[model samples]
Target: MADIEPYENALDAIPGAHPYPRTSRYHDAEIGIHRQADGTEVRYAKRRLLPPIEDRTGDDTQSHTVRTGERPDLLGRRYFGDPGQWWQIADANPVLDPRELTDEPGREIDVPLAGHFPRSPQGDRRG
Candidate 1:
């Protein structure tokens, strides 16, 4: 028998982990998932509408910090060219306060990419 390593977040295990940003236009969303006849699980992909990117890095921008006010929809539009793509950003950063738009300034945090794909309801990965 072979020992298997426990699964962990790639970014969590490594310091300063920065994955390449993905294009929201190129993301395939799962509409549904099911087990195949061979006992293999498969996901059904659907073309989804992504949100827009809203860069709040202005004079009020905090240093090395991610603000809760940074709307994913806004970001989707700025980065992926659509406001509907906000879910992708939300899915990437679940710790963020979706309701609150602004966070404490000067807090270190992760900035989700256009297609980062968060597991939140907005992302809707159940499909």
Candidate 2:
């Protein structure tokens, strides 16, 4: 705690740091900061919000039965054609970690239509 710096300077100081990829679940989330009473600033990415599973029904989503050795990235590749978009499947189901989606064989998981980024029905992003 010898030095106190502005929040923006944190990430800016990192040389050649790459931003999150488009396929990342965090692609749309903006950086955020929290200021402490003592003047320290903590920077972080805002939480990426996902709607409840019930809202994803119909044309926007379908179902897939998880198989042995199946993984979210592989599922993303097969369905969305981009292995990095696995977060889409994570959001569609009720799991904090995408790995849980494929934890059991024969488990049914939600698969959104390709490129169907789930936004609130009202078309707003609160995150």
Candidate 3:
């Protein structure tokens, strides 16, 4: 057995530490442990499923032209009022790399209105 950290997230069922960055895209992701043959416990955050492009974008979405020297953190603050929520901007765009959205000036990017995803980590859109 290896050293293990403890946790008390009300949403989590397993006994392990939750991921850092409470506002991160992986905030609600479950903690997984891989037991090696040597009994070493490798803990990792499970994969986070991105919401559908359509769900994240709609007629209400805002289109902003990227300016030179602009960054996602700043954009997040401008839009969501929290720099850590930058992932919301990334989710609204189609670019695999969020940095690319700001790399070139004059590129229009989609800014979803008030984050389009649900409160759950599973992206439960059944409602």
TM-score of each predicted structure versus truth:
0.31, 0.67, 0.71
- CA lDDT for candidate 2: 0.72
Best by TM-score: 3
Candidate 3 lDDT, tens digit per residue, 20-46? 544567776666899999999998977
Q: How displaced is residue 53 in candidate 1, in Å?
A: 21
Number of colliding residue pairs in each model: 29, 0, 0
Candidate rank order under lDDT: 2, 3, 1
Which candidate model has the greater TM-score, 1 or 3? 3
List runs of model 2 lying over 4 Å from the truth.
1-19, 35-42, 120-127
Model 1's alpha-carbon lDDT is 0.43
Ranking of models by TM-score: 3, 2, 1
- On TM-score, who's better, 2 or 3? 3
lDDT by residue for model 2 over 43-67, one digit each (tens)?
7877766776666558888889999
